[model samples]
Structures are given as structure tokens and as C-alpha cells.
Target: MKSPYSAKIVQPDISLSICGYSKVLEIVSNKWTALVVYAMEDGVIRYGEIRRRIEGISKKMLTQTLRQLERNGLVKRVITPSVPPIVEYSLTRLGESLLGPMRVLNQWTKENYSLVEQARASYDQAYYEE
Candidate 1:
């Protein structure tokens, strides 16, 4: 028997999938990646400063996130030949291009998070009452 609520599933066109949304999300969806990008967005910064700016991120996680960003061409790392070899991180042109969209999403979240919380609360209340 067919359910009334069941709807036909349609696959998205491959042409509409530019660069693969999942591939991009896989890179940016990590909890630490966005924070790390925002940390260096202001200017070139050292590894230690990035770790300090983002609270609760472990050293290992920070290192991994930086490497992933670098690997994706979104972040650039420069090592100065010094007695201790100073390393700095900065956003490349590609990374800077992402800022505009990210800012829009950030603004949307800031504006709608309260509404989302209210919806969640209402849903939970009704769900529990049932």
C-alpha cells in the first residue's frame, strides 16, 4: 500500500552541482575550520595566536584544521627561516572570496537563531505533550 505522505524522489542534475556541494561542505563543515579561517581573516597570524583566539580547540585539532585549509588552497602558510623557524598563516585570494558568503550566512544565523530556538522549543513541547 502506498502512503499518502510519500513523495517521489528526484535526483539533482549533475550540471547544477558545481564543484560538488558535499565536497565543499566536507572541507568547511568541520567545527574548527571556520573558526580558524575567521581567526586569520584579520591579518597574517602565527600558529599560537590562532590557538588562543579559538577557545576549547585542542592543539592537535588546530594543527589538523590548518593543514586541511592549506591543502584546500583556502589558506596559505609561510615559514620564515629563523633560529626557530617562524610560521604564519594567512588567507589566500580564494579564501578571501569565501568571506562574503560566509558573512551572509553568519548574519542570517545571528538574525534567525532565536526563531529557530523558539521553533525547537515549541516542537519539543508539543512532542512531549503528545
Candidate 2:
């Protein structure tokens, strides 16, 4: 089964010119990054909370995403003094700046979700439904 990624091409010039796109490609390109961001959208959340909210994200992946997002200035890491040291992840003001585009993305997904499901159903029916 050839997948869409098999057709995904790397464009050097465009990748270089568009810093915003490059930033997205650099940070959110990871499978778990957007999900992690979405998880933190409501408010500041902890590691365990985020991990539980987003299913199937391994500890390593979540850790790496958090670090990358932190490095990208989109997320801030807070460590508290507690019985066992509490760590929380929150979006920085810079991260808050992404709200508009993220909201737009969410709206687009919501609006087109049914269409995607239909496409997937048709594709699955054609390919593997037998």
C-alpha cells in the first residue's frame, strides 16, 4: 500500500524561505507535537496529565516534544518544589501567539473531518474491505 508520504517531496528553496513554515516543519513535524500542543491548549498541565490526555505517546516522545517546544519558545517548563518535584508544561506568550493558526487548523479539521472519514472509508473499502 503506497501511502501519501511516499509522494511527499522535500523542497529545499521553499523550506529555506518560509521561516514560519520551517519553524512548523522543525517543531510540529513530529507526530506528537501538535497533539501535545493541543493538550496544553486549555491551560498549564503536568507531564502525567498530558501523557494521559494524549494516548499512545511514549514517555520518550513526550519528553522530546516538550524539549523541542521549549527550545522553540512555544512552551515553558516549570518545576516546583514538592514532595517529589512537580514539573508542568505551559505555553509561553510566544506560544499563545500560535492560538489563531491552531484554532484555524482545529476548525478546518472539524469542518473537513467527515470528508476525511468518507475518503478513508472509500479508500479502505476499495483496498482492504474484502
Candidate 3:
């Protein structure tokens, strides 16, 4: 059927099966999502707290990440009427459940960091040396 704008792009059956994986990649593969997941590991945190704990993140990026996380139902935004306003973010049950995979990824990264460093050093020494 014809819609308003552009034609559709069709794919093979195998490609269709990969859509689930693609969604997972889209959500968790992001830079800030990982950080937000790790931050929520301990418990709930206010918006400002999430910002403060994870450094080098501008307000725009922080807002974007939070929205993405919320969209995926991996995080919840709580707002309470208070002086100067109060907003907080916390993982939902679904988000909390992701702790296992997220933590595994974190552990793997930490454990393999030394190997990665060594590999980078070796590569530099072999190819980048004067």
C-alpha cells in the first residue's frame, strides 16, 4: 500500500529474525544507557545525582539518555511536587532484571581491561613506534 512519503525497504527472512537483537543493541549498546544502568545498580537516584555521579555528561546528553531509558521501560521517572521541584529516576523491575547482563558486561570489561591495554600497547609499539 502507498503511504505519503517514501517507499519501503524489504529484507530477507533471516534479517527479520534479527530485529530483536537489533533492538537490544540499540538500547544497551548506547554510551549513556550503560552508565545509567550501572548507576541505578545501588538504588534510586535523583536526576541531579545521576548527573553528578556520571561525569563529563552535559545536560542535553543526560536528558536524552534518560528519555531513551524511559522509552525502553528500563527506567522510571518520578516527580514530586516540592519547592524548586524534585525529579528522580530509578530502574523498574524490568530494568532491575537487566542487572545480570549489564553487570556481566561490566565485569567482563573490567577483567579484560589489562589485556586490552596490553594489546593496545603492543600494537603501538609494533606499528606506531618511531
Off by over 4 Å in 2: 1-19, 116-130
* Candidate 2 vs candidate 3, lDDT winner: 2
lDDT of 2 at 61: 92
Which is the better candidate, 1 or 2, if ranked by TM-score? 1
Assess the local accuracy of residue 12 in candidate 2 as a C-alpha lDDT between 0 and 100.
46
lDDT string for model 1 (67-120, tens) is 999999999999999989999999999999888878888999999999999999
Candidate 2 C-alpha lDDT tens digits along 1-130: 9996787676644645566777577767788888998899888999999999998999999998999899999999999999999999999988888777878988999999999999999999999978
Going through the candidates in the order shown, the clash numbers are: 0, 0, 0
Clashes of 3: 0
Q: Which one is best on lDDT? A: 1
* Runs with alpha carbons beyond 4 Å of true place in candidate 1: 1-19
Model 1's alpha-carbon lDDT is 0.90
Q: Give the candidates in order of lDDT, highest first.
A: 1, 2, 3
Off by over 4 Å in 3: 1-20
Candidate 2: global Cα-lDDT? Answer: 0.88
Per-residue lDDT for 57 in model 2? 96
- Clashing residue pairs, candidate 2? none
